[model samples]
Target: MSNYEKYLETQLQDLDFKEEYDNLEAEYQIIKAIIDARLELNLTQQELSAKTGIKQSNLSRIENGNCSPTVHTLSKIARGLDKQLVIKFV
Candidate 1:
């Protein structure tokens, strides 16, 4: 494994680190999904911003996990991508 991966793996063995990581897992998943979907549609942040009427800087922050987007914001992004937003408890 790469050094970073190795270090992360070691960190994950710690209970505190593992708990904190788990807490952020959902946020990470959301960020990854947004990024992946955008790429799959071949849309840049700027293009998505124009389509969604959200500022490109805001979208960048959302994609980078630097900010939390509300359900309303997420819905706008989904519509911009010609997608439907579905949230569920699993």
Candidate 2:
């Protein structure tokens, strides 16, 4: 793992940090999934926004965790990227 990844793992050992991390895990995964998909297809936020008709600013907010994306918004983004958005319960 990278130094930053190792650092994060070490920091997460703290009880308080672990608690907060667990709480935000789902949201973090969602953001990471969207970003990973976009990067996998070599699309920029502006390009994806144009294709999805979602404002670039909103896309930025979603990626940065400044705002939550609704299912409808996620669907549009997925469709624009020719992918499916799957919600799993585990």
Candidate 3:
């Protein structure tokens, strides 16, 4: 591995760093999935906001996973994107 990568791996060996990294990675995955779905529908955040009647800023927050969207809000967003939201319980 490259020096930088090795350094990161070494740092991630710490419990706190590993937990934080895992959380961030999970958030990144969710955001990426949302962005990918939006791209698949060729809809920008503004377009999604217009269709769902949700504010663009709120959509931004949702994409960032900084804001938790209600079930109704998520349904609206999925409908705006011509998709459906599925939740699986483990």
Candidate 4:
């Protein structure tokens, strides 16, 4: 597990933190997926920014898990990458 994952396990001990963490888990996963997708395509932040119309600095923040992007923003990114955003429940 990652350091962040370990930290979350500890936070889950606290009911309030657990609730908030649970709510944000999906968002975090999406951030990871976005970064991974970019890397898989061997695209630089600058390149992706040009494709997505998002600033490179903002893209850095988003990939670093420091920013929360809206669904529309994510869709823009997906389109730039020649991918589609698909949400699923399991």
Measure candidate 1: CA RMSD. 4.2
Scanning candidate 4 in windows of ten residues, the lowest lDDT window is 1-10
For model 1, how does the per-residue alpha-carbon lDDT over 5-70 read when each residue is reduced to its tens digit? Answer: 476689889999899879998886777678778887999999999999999999999987799999
lDDT tens digits by residue: candidate 3, 1-88: 5443576579788999888878787555556667778877889999989999999999999886787677788788888988888866
**Which residue pairs in model 4 clash with each other?**
none
Error in Å for residue 31 of model 2: 0.2
Which 10 successive residues of model 2 have the least lDDT summed?
A: 1-10
Model 3: runs farther than 4 Å from truth?
1-18, 24-29
RMSD of each: 4.2, 2.8, 6.0, 3.6
Residue 7, model 1, lDDT: 64
The deviation in Å at residue 35 for candidate 4 is: 1.0
Per-model TM values vs. the true structure = 0.78, 0.80, 0.67, 0.70
The model with the greatest TM-score is 2
Ranking by TM-score: 2, 1, 4, 3
lDDT of 4 at 70: 87
Tell me the lDDT of candidate 4. Answer: 0.84
lDDT of 4 by residue, 15-89 (tens): 997788688888778876786688779999999999989999988888777888888988999988889999889
Which residue pairs come into collision in candidate 2? Answer: none
